[model samples]
Target chain A: MDERMTDAVLATEELTVRFGGHVAVDRVTCRFRAGELTAIVGPNGAGKTTYFNLISGQIPATGGRVLLGGRDVTRLSVAARTRLGVGRAFQLTNLFPDLSVLENVRLVIQSRRGRDFDMWSMAAAHADLAEAAEAVLERVRMTDLAGRKVAALSHGDQRKLEVAMLIALDPKVYMFDEPTAGMSVDEAPVVLELIAALKAQTDRTILLVEHKMDVIARLADRIIVLHNGALAADGPPREVIASDVVQEAYMGKALEDV
Target chain B: MLKRILSGDMPQSRALGLILLAILIGLAFAPFLFPGTRSLDTAARICVFVALAASYDLLLGYAGIVSFAHTMFFGLGAYGVALASDGMGRSFGALAAGSLAGALAAAALALLVGLFSLRVRAIFFAMITLAVASAVAVLFSQLSGITGGEDGLNYRIPRALTAAARYAEEPFLGMRLTGKVLNYYLVFFGALILFLALLRVVNSPFGRVLQAIRENEFRAEAIGCRVVWHRTAATVISAVSAALAGSLYAIWLRYVGPDTVLSFEIMVDILLMVVIGGMGTMYGAAVGAALFVLAQNYLQALMGAAAEAAAGVPGLPLILDPDRWLLWLGALFILSVYFFPTGVVGRLRGR
Candidate 1:
């Protein structure tokens, strides 16, 4: 962690979640700084996704609280958190399969701009909204597929669209849970490039939970390794990957395969 | 129509809207064109149901909520006018105030139900509404002093709306512009304006979010929509529209009864209207309501005569009996589901 960058954009104070007796996420505390790319990598059942869910307000916390920009947002709904700028891309492909790509992106932009409740106005009548939607599509290189339905898009392209939606939201903190989890070998890097471009494009803080090491190594400036449900190691990527604890517990033979 | 379709995102609705517009115009001049009591009555019923079914679609088709409490709100509106006119003297002001009261009450009930039950599973939401509606129906029936019990309520409307009253100067098509004619036009014009307003609502930005929520609630919520609130608003809007339809029905019939407006059969009729016409398609409601009302009026008589004529035949008696008309309707519904799986309008639009 940089000393001058002491202001935490997202912080979990002893965040805990348990499914009955099974502790999915056990008392984890960490601070994500502004404008830095952080990766949460671990073996399967590491509770990385659960941690993301807690912060994104996808699920209620059994214990502890979540803070964003130094404000307590633990009890807020997923939508409330989203309005306050916590954007999430799900592990599964979560785009609206029935709606057009442009519509999907436009809904995100509309939600962020608080125009979703405009019942009397035509959706296409707003020029600013259309321009904003088009701008996000251009940024994610999906302007060509704007008219196409989300279900018709390729897996890689759909992933890009999800990122495009987050961009439309213009969230201050982004939480991506295994964004490239289901992609083919060729398609994985294309998604990574899109996500990687997000860092350079905006000064938003990003936290991603990824299984693959190479993708994490390429994008994450800082890495947090998890074993079971607790943080095993947290530091600069080079130092964290070099630690004996991460090597012994989670990343031992995993790094070798990559 | 072409300009509206081009300006709106819902292209398929244009055809449905035009068809409904033509039907409304034809019904408005039914006395002039097709002069008969039965034809006039059927036309008036179509107007009432078009509003009811279309409002039901706001919840069922657009918001994707299955509510069985619709006719409860409908009955409340009829009773609202009947009771207010009876007590406050037969005046148009009293009728309008009563109908407005009914609409507001129904909206409040819908909001309360939505706030509590909308958070549950979809099927549970349906079951909760059905239970509440049944309870309200029972309450209306048992309160004989206020609701007139099983006999129902019959009260005089304003003098100009009474059956004998007529326009003294200009006769419409050699016939006096009687109260029935005035009532027919009232229902016709009222249903049209409300239906068009509903079309405007479903085509707006708010309606798009409703479609989104119907498609995927989790995704909708994650995208910053207040899902429960949206569902609640849909319920209120739908309830108010159904109540208005009920008011029209009461005024046209000059009577309000449990069997006529508050029964589960009426709810079933509304459901069939949406399903057969098509869910989520605004125009389908009008088509469905018109077809169903026409069949109910004409087919019952046709089937009864056929059954009476075929009384000597062995199996024909059982099959063609007027009471077994539901069996024929069931078969037709099944065939409709099979052939026009998306619905009449949905299929017409090639969706």
Candidate 2:
């Protein structure tokens, strides 16, 4: 609703990704404004995750460029992009299985704080790092499980921990790939509430690839519907759900309430 | 007492501190209690290999990088000290300076090797290091004028570090202060300090990242950690520690050769030490090195006596004979692996 909030944007210009004869993601152009939560909804194998990967620099783009805060970042590495304030959570839980919850969050904080290469100092001796990690954990309501090993945590808790890690990195743009894929119906709302809480914060951009239409409808300001590796619909949630093309491609039963 | 000083927040840190303390006391009192040159010699060898194996653990256990080029760096260190002694004349200053140079050279070589090779996957990285290591060994063996070819270089060390020089005339604790005893202390204190330094390095914040990378490199990269640079640093530190051990070995034996220092056998020995002692646990490196060096040195004699006793027994002598010691060693290695999968430390920890 605010014109100033729309000034900062991340856009893809004619992006394409091809694997031999098949194209995983076709040429697509879109923009996600700052301080807004945009949902990318599509069926399985619809290139939603792949497109997220392309923008996050996890996979090389076959053509076109990714603009991060208006700077061309197609050639930047995954780590370089992360340093430039791009954070992502995987579809599968990619975490340090052997490390404790506190340690897992602390590692991300340590890297962001520029202490990853500190050879002479002890990790525990850094009071500020612990405080910062604990602060993020507190925000995610995971401080009680800080000392627990990540492998022992439930799947929902692990996802929450991942969100905690992203908060520790404090990125400008957050890319969440199926953050609640494995959570039960009861557990899913907890994650949704966390995401909603983040969405309420000003000047933060979120690109979420979620399969739950209810989640997309509740939190998304704009919805980008992808079908067969191409952009089929891009507009507000209500307008996109009403579109016949979206209804035929993906919004069959999921958009019944709308 | 020393355990309290070296203990940390890590799991098994107290155990590591105890092992280091035991090594300190055992080697310091070895010459007095055993009262022989052979015992002193064995103690020095154990100290050297302990340092070498622990250095290797920094890479294999912490960084999760398997390298076959370890002995090449060891050889470089030995050669650095041996060649320096030959040119500068044996003195404390010369030996110290030479060892420093040698360690630096080894670290530099590790940096270069790691930078180029660490970009590949784990298995390919191992193969490339193996290839490069073999080439370096060949180069050393061929360069007869400088490296002494296959015969290797034999040079004198400082008098205080030699087995011939006597530090005192009167006996202390029923042990004579011969060159051997004095040299034993030199190697003992030097190896102790080096091992502890490496321990400090592994317990530091940087070592935490190294272990994180070991657990998951992709996640580490995703969190903005530079995997290659971290691995390169670990490799360099490991190489430098190995070089220190190699320098001590060169001074102890008063010789450095391709077969003795740069051979694949030494690298395999280091690997066995890590595996048997427990990879990742620094204390395990010391335990593994001590057990292996002692076994390699005396197992044949023990088997020889057994075979001689069973000479009249038909099939018994064949398997237990000293001449078939390699078979016995192979069996022991397998038994260790099967029984102590986590290593000796792992077994002691009841895991």
Candidate 3:
């Protein structure tokens, strides 16, 4: 355990955030390592999304530190954290609704290359960025819809575009907030396969906050469960699933209310 | 060649393309086509407004920043030139110096505003800009010695650009070959180049980032584009461009006053043009500015003619009264906004 501690790629030390008197994420202390896919499971308002927000620099932590490769990034902006190799995909399918799908992905590619601020050069003039964008879209099988406006895309396609943008960034730590929330049966498999491919690399950390237990069972090597803004369980997926703390935290409360 | 010039961002609609071309040709030969003092003045005003409106569009349309401070930047340019010409004497060097100074000052002030307020909510930022703009307007009027206070500053330009200096012995192409014609061309070409530069910018990588930010700022930040910095950069560029347009307006009028250049009405006019023409496209600025200026200048005369034609026709004559032209203009604006929520260009483009 002591030796494995040093190998952690991403770690949070007692991270917390408060909304007035209420705490959204409370003292989430955990170390995430490369070669691991950790699924964060929780009931609604379990602070799972808030924890992800804390780690990804969406909301500043009220206390404690977020360490990326042992360096504290608690005060960094979201873009600064992204530059430090942290990437995030939103639960809400955040995208450039007015732009074409190709331009949407191309913008991220340009940003990743640090060429987004080249004011004089035409974006179309840079064929390389477009080609790279196409390649990422191809991975998500969205090449046919390249010219389609994002607003015109179906919900599943928008989710695919969201993943394509994240792939374009190619960050070291992938933070996905409900990657397949609204995906259909067929669409979910495509996204799951892509996530599997990323996990196969085994040199980058993947953090997923999800409600789908089946997905957590299939892809997650380890599971971290949160209940009422506190960690309830953390261990191998099966052990964490069977743990009494998990059952009592959300399940028992839900059953009692029912 | 034209495609290259447009940076491959075509107007995308044939009718829109033709309309833009007609506007281009008409402005290019305005003095020759409509040879009169009032017409030339109207044409000059159109050129300056086109550039001004387009620069404002870069913020309101492309980047989705609501800024009322645009006229403040324009005022800075006008005053920059007014002071330079007033202090440095009538010379080409003074014009150049004033124009450059105005652009720089506008850019610097925009940078400060963006840094301080961009991180706030969009509506709040708009309020902040409104406050800043009104403050600047007040400052321009209060600083009497420097800005000429309420009376305003009347300055001269180089002999070559004034109406007294005739370049040729005879009028050419039914237009006098005087310094005034040269000044008109200067305004026309400067506006043209500035409009094209703005077009190119909207097609660039930086411009795409701005669109993305407008679409989803949090996602842009999550994807590694510093949202605030990008917004600030866009604000500076828009301010500088507006300042330059203000410089051209000052040169054309040979006077600088709060009412002439820095008025809030100018800002409201810019908003109307962008919305009426189309918000997101640069061509919208050209079309919107032309149409609005034409209506403002000629709509009353056209109404007077109609009123006379409808003499003793009950409500028709009363409705067509020249003094009530603004009522008709308001009705037209409402009709357009109702029929084309995306503006004329956006509706014409069919996307």
Query: TM-scores of all models?
Result: 0.94, 0.94, 0.97
Native contacts retained by candidate 3: 0.89
- For model 2, residues B1-351, the per-residue Cα lDDT tens digits are 354234353335467557656766887799987787777788889999999999999999989999999998898888888889888888877678879988999988899999998989999999988998999999999999988999998888877766567778888889888887777777888888877777777777788888889988888888888889999999999999889889989888889999989999999999999999998888889899988988888889999999989999999998897988888888999999999999988777766
Candidate 3 lDDT tens digits, B197-247: 998898899999998998888888988999999999999999999999999
Please state the CAPRI-style docking class of candidate 3: high
Number of the top DockQ candidate: 3
Name the 10 consecutive residues with the lowest summed lDDT in model 1 chain B: B2-11
Best-fitting candidate, measured by lDDT? 3
Query: What value of lDDT does candidate 3 attain over all alpha carbons?
Result: 0.91
Query: Ranking by TM-score, best first?
Result: 3, 2, 1
Task: Name the regions of candidate 3 deviating beyond 4 angstroms.
Answer: A247-258
Off by over 4 Å in 2: A1-6, B1-21, B305-317
Q: What is the C-alpha RMSD of each candidate to the true structure, in Å?
A: 2.5, 2.4, 2.3
Candidates' chain A TM-scores: 0.92, 0.94, 0.95
